[model samples]
Target chain A: MRKFLGLVGAVALLAACETAPTDGANANASGDAAAQKLGPAAGSAQDFVVNVGDRVFFGFDQYNISADARSTLEKQAMWLKKFPGVTIVLEGHADERGTREYNLALGERRANAAKEYLVSLGVDAMRIKTISYGKERPVALGHNEAAWTQNRRAVTVVTVGAGS
Target chain B: MKFCVRFLTLAVLLFSSQAWAELRVDITQGRVEPMPLAVVEFTGDNSDAAQIGAQIAQVVSADLERSGLFRPIDPKAFIQKELSMTTLPRFGDWRILNAQALVQGHAVPQANGELAIQFRLWDVNAETQMVGLAYNTVADNWRRVAHIIADTIYQRITGESGYFDTRIVYVAESGPANKRVKRLAIMDQDGAKHRFLTDGLDLVLTPRFSPTLQEITYLSYYKNTPRVYLFNIDSGRQSILGDFPGMTFAPRFSFDGTKVVMSMARDGNSDIYTMDLATRQTRRVTRHSSIDTSPSYSPDGKSIAFNSDRGGSQQIYVMDSTGKNVRRISFGKGRYATPVWSPRGDLIAFTKMTGGKFYIGVMRTDGSGERLLADGYLVESPTWAPNGRVLMFYRETLRGEKKTTKLYSVDLTGYNEREVITPLEGSDPAWSPLIP
Candidate 1:
């Protein structure tokens, strides 16, 4: 009789362990799904946030496509493909070293350069729109080279749309 | 003994030569304070006529004083008893009253049923007649005669063109912040005779008059899209400059008023483009990865001064008309924007932001000698008066629970700061040429 009680106790313990193990695995999977939803993943990629501290440089007031800018756009394009439904607005900015009107024009060219590269990588051109704030808005207000590099950037802002 | 004699002779020769030459009193360091003069009642043929003459003289006095460069003295303090322009005044009387200059004038009715106005400016210290001018106009144009007389005297004393007979074209605002309405308004420099060119059907910003004072080009948001529109001052007709598929803002007429320079945005980028008003041909001046706007032409129309962020932050830059040979001019401690070339071509005025504060400043074209003239919560859009002696800009104040913006003017010397009176909140002031 004691031997029989031991077997029943072992069965009850195994049943409780099985329930707890399945619950933990479910929690882990959901956390990963949330992360994948927030960030770029495989299969669907187009709109990706540039990591903090990364920079996109221009060639002396020229906003034409450059090799380095292409490499950066390549990475962004991969992430954008992972999230196919995302639409983006490319914001072009200029540093505080030129006239207001010319800076505005330069900013437009910069944003367009990024947009063209993305479209070449199979991102829909219709998914992107550009806006030049001229010198009206500045992310870094310092009067130094470091601040200017940050201010002169083309940012891809993601939004939810019907593409996916 | 022989050397000493030669030295003494040379010294005497030098002193006499300096004295015989024009005694130029390097007047650069004078008190920029306005000169004080007295305009008394003109003693005429009849008492009733004298009252009318006095009224005309008073108007002239007010015109000069309001310029912020002159101070009209009280007639009651006049030391001279003779107020007639035909008679020679007692110059010693004006000197005793601390008047550096005195104006005496008389008005008489002519046989042709017109008014003949005669005026004279007297130098109190030199005890001599400085200038005398005469004008014949109908009785209703007495105010204009006063202005002309003021201009003549102002030119003689200050040795500069007078700005009393000028006007200003500015954007007038009404209603609340989100759904505000703006109209292009023109008024005398003293803020009189305010007239609205547009019936508030659309929004307007930055209205600048042509060099001929006959046309204006400004940015308007008429069809839910912002574009530069040109309007004839006399005909009251309007037209758009180009059919850009995107936004266009910050428009200015070229120095010759033949071309319009503005910023056009397409595909999420804005670039500086110019269009010939007569030909309607468009050309892209800048192709850059940065935002460039607020372009101004040099007085000679050879170069343009604009604001950009290509260097990572906003700064002032100058370039040739074809967008070549570009050079950055501003290297100050703050972010500089809205660079405007002075009409005199000596300085460029701009708005600077630093340390959470904004300042109106002027710098030489080469980006040297940056001087901040004024500070406020927010200051932008520095426009030069036609003479380049004064700047008119707008300032915003951050106080209480609401924000307020108003127009203000300051001389290039950083003195004579005064608030430009407007009926409502206003910004983006552009001074116009003197009316012909």
Candidate 2:
């Protein structure tokens, strides 16, 4: 009975480890307050994510800003205005469906699409930087379209603000 | 390509071997039956030498068998047990076993600590020596000698250069799907003598070997900045290839090894560029808004083949080395990426996606003679062996919730697909030119 329980515990631990976006040290340290399940502090990185949503999705092979993404960018633009001293980095990612080199270019286009939208919405372009992870870093773990739709997104990471 | 010219040369032995003028093997086209040949264990003077000789024969047999052109006959069927190396084999014995050819050799220990090895290839039915040679090497490097002998046999039979004596550089991957740790790794073409070229602190991908030097050009994400870097295998030194304002990736060497062509993405756009290694001067190859990457130079260095989406879909395009004479070469129903020109300049291997299936295929220079060599759920990055007879690529499949990525190789005939065994998951394999 003890051996059976131990095996079950080990499998559960493996499942938990495989499903999350465990991008090494920084990722583990980023979500302490959220893990505690408390209401996020105002203007915190968690607050920005919980209130205004930091990610915007793109269509397959299309880098043009969509109407839905524009809505999210509008909210992000207002948040940036509230925290004028905040600096953000736009991280572009692609689905694993494409080649490595092409996905990198497409990812850059996705991030720049969000960056250009933020610039047009009255945020300072200098305060925002863009980097493309291609398909190397994904937030999701599946190989289906559900995961791909989430993978093909540009995430706004708060570089300097409440987290610091 | 010059240092080992003497020991490497297989003395053709023209006048004595070619008494019969009939062609034995033709692997250029069509389906080929693996020529049945008897590869006997080499005889040696001492026990240590005998063990080494048997190991050499095993390697030689495995190398020839892996090529899919020759079938090493099972040694258990040998009718005659003991035989002297100098005396020719009884032709009737080999003929009884239906072996078209016979191979025998002897290993002797030299006084100065080198090993002297002599091998002969006999056309059993022709009743004559097809080819024979003796070479010397340090005892530890007997595996290399075996590979060289395999190449000699392959060339003598098939009339094409063998890819046995080569190395492959690839990306070694671990961790999980979201945050993978990738390091640069290299090994023998048959997956022996493996070594890691970089620590896994940073991400690296797509390493390519220089055509004429022991250097590698690849993409590295050092200090969290993704760019192309060159590494010298002998010195263990690495440096960024060029100073570009934007992100640089997808680097490959020109045929002459004088220039490196790569893609630089700036402000949401990527284009092809070439940089001279000696002068550090840069030349832009493509000035387009669309993504143009994965640039490969032709063997003659007159043309450049690259992947671009300029025609509204991902396709392969060829232009003059100066970026003129633009032409689309893929008119098929799928999108193509990573167009690598064969070292022989006859075909271009590429990754194609259609109907949600990824295929590694090869096409003629003009985009005709399209042949899909291998297909899977997701396959990308097709690189050719130095001889241009086989291709190595990575294949990924989803098993339950886990993703399995592995390296695979297949010859041009669409048969003989093999999984190249590596310690860890490997991708983006680049086959080096034959080590001289």
Candidate 3:
């Protein structure tokens, strides 16, 4: 449980050098324009979705977190730790390939896996809630593997409101 | 879903096959040549009756044609076009076109606003009246009358009960793959009387029918919290079925419609549970850390077949009613889900995913004699017709196009596959037993 706590403490020390698909700089840039209209206030839901990396992807039909997801989760934990009063809801989703009911259960497994990681990172378990949408709500629209890779994910939604 | 046969059993096999050639449709064997049948336009005593009569005959013909056991000969092939209620059908004319059977009927509109339909099935090869029956229903229920008539003819010739006069409750999907709007929809076996049960405000899935009533148990994303719900189709009323502390889903009615068996996820792990309808009491049926879901009851309500990943990958497992004697039933290469017990109590239908492909398959109760019926890009949720001879599931296209889901049914032989027409894209179809 103590393995990931304070492991990636220096976000600025890494200097945003890597350029993975989930790189924070790239996502922040996309959310920047919308941030102006949507108001990505510090510790706001918009800020979490745009800057703190509120979502992470999984492999096909696999709920185990990937190495890429670790950096995102680390950022999410840092944001949650900074906002002591802000509670969050984690939503797990699946690709469209699996059966309906099993996918529902699988999505729950993914969300709980993320919750467990957050708890391991020192986030309060009582402050976090989880839900599974299965394949009902998808972020990607295509029928191919590329879209599915994006759809199989867990999203962290800040429930503490933007004004906070 | 219990069918109410209102008509008296007016049908009787009057003649033995020894006196004439047997005009039976052999349904047990696979790859059978459809028996040629001629369904005439049912006559009427009045103009209104004539129009309704024609519609009824068309519905009956469509039902028979879709079964794959009967090929309705075109009306143009009929030598005697004018079929009357009292007069016998010209068996010689049907024999000329090689039609083994001929059907003639008449519709009469009663003064009490009721419609009565009388029909006769003649074995053309035998030149004898194989069966005859009459049905009286409200004028608005003429469609159901047609279905009942079709069932009668099918049973008389096939020597097995019919699957017509049934209904299907499914999630009707619209919009794009990412923003699909799913609503509860119901229709007859032939896709008639289509109507939406839900307004699509909340996401819904996997609507299943009670074997004994006009009730459906399903999973609904109401108030953004997923749970099992029960819907009374007759009253347009809905209620949450399980008031558990955790998420409840994948619900199915017990054979007697007295309880709902489903999966509940608590602390991230899912396990099967059964809730009695009378007492609103729930009993945990499976205790495991891994996922245990998609519970279905055997016809006798003695055992249950469910999908579980306790063995590391999804597979079918069987356990007694008390959740004891747990045994894995599927030993296939791919992951299995949705193990639906057949009404006949001898087979279980399932969806198997292997080698990146999906299949709707069936196997014996013990999981032996596994046979794949249909395969495609995405196929799942296999439900049985009341007769247990046909299986219905939904399919999706996942390549070279925007993904789309639709309903389909395949018989046991696997040779007669047909798409069930719907108003929109459909998925997670649950077939009701024969409707009375």
Residue clash pairs of candidate 3: B3-B436, B4-B436
Q: Model 3 off-target regions past 4 Å?
A: A1-39, A161-164, B1-5, B8-21
Q: What TM-score does each prediction get for chain A alone?
A: 0.64, 0.76, 0.75
Off by over 4 Å in 2: A1-38, A161-164, B1-15, B19-23
Local accuracy of candidate 3 as per-residue lDDT tens digits, B210-302: 987589998888988899999999888999985688889999999998989999999789999999999999999999998999999999999
Error of 1 at A6 (Å): 56
Tens-digit lDDT string for candidate 2 (B1-436)? 1223227335345426775346467777766989999999998999988888999899899999998888999999988666676676888998999999888877889897878887888888888887778788888888888888898888888889899989999999999977798999999888988999999999898899998759999999898788999999888899998788888999999989999999998888999999999999999999999999999999999999999999998999999999999999999998999999999999999999999999999999999999999999899989898889999999998888788899999999988889999999999999999887
lDDT tens string, model 2, A1-164? 24323332343344434533353345455467555564456677766765677788887898987777787789999999999888998999999999999998899889988999999999999998888899999877888886787788898988786642
Q: How close is chain B to the truth by TM-score, in each candidate?
A: 0.88, 0.96, 0.96
Error of 3 at A33 (Å): 13
The local lDDT score (0 to 100) that residue B419 gets in candidate 2 is: 96
Categorize the docking of model 2.
medium
Ordered from best to worst lDDT, the candidate numbers read 2, 3, 1
- Model 2, backbone clash pairs (residues 3+ apart or across chains), number: 0
Q: Each prediction's Cα lDDT score?
A: 0.70, 0.87, 0.85
Residue B250, model 2: lDDT of 92
Query: B356 in model 2: Cα distance from truth in Å?
Result: 0.8
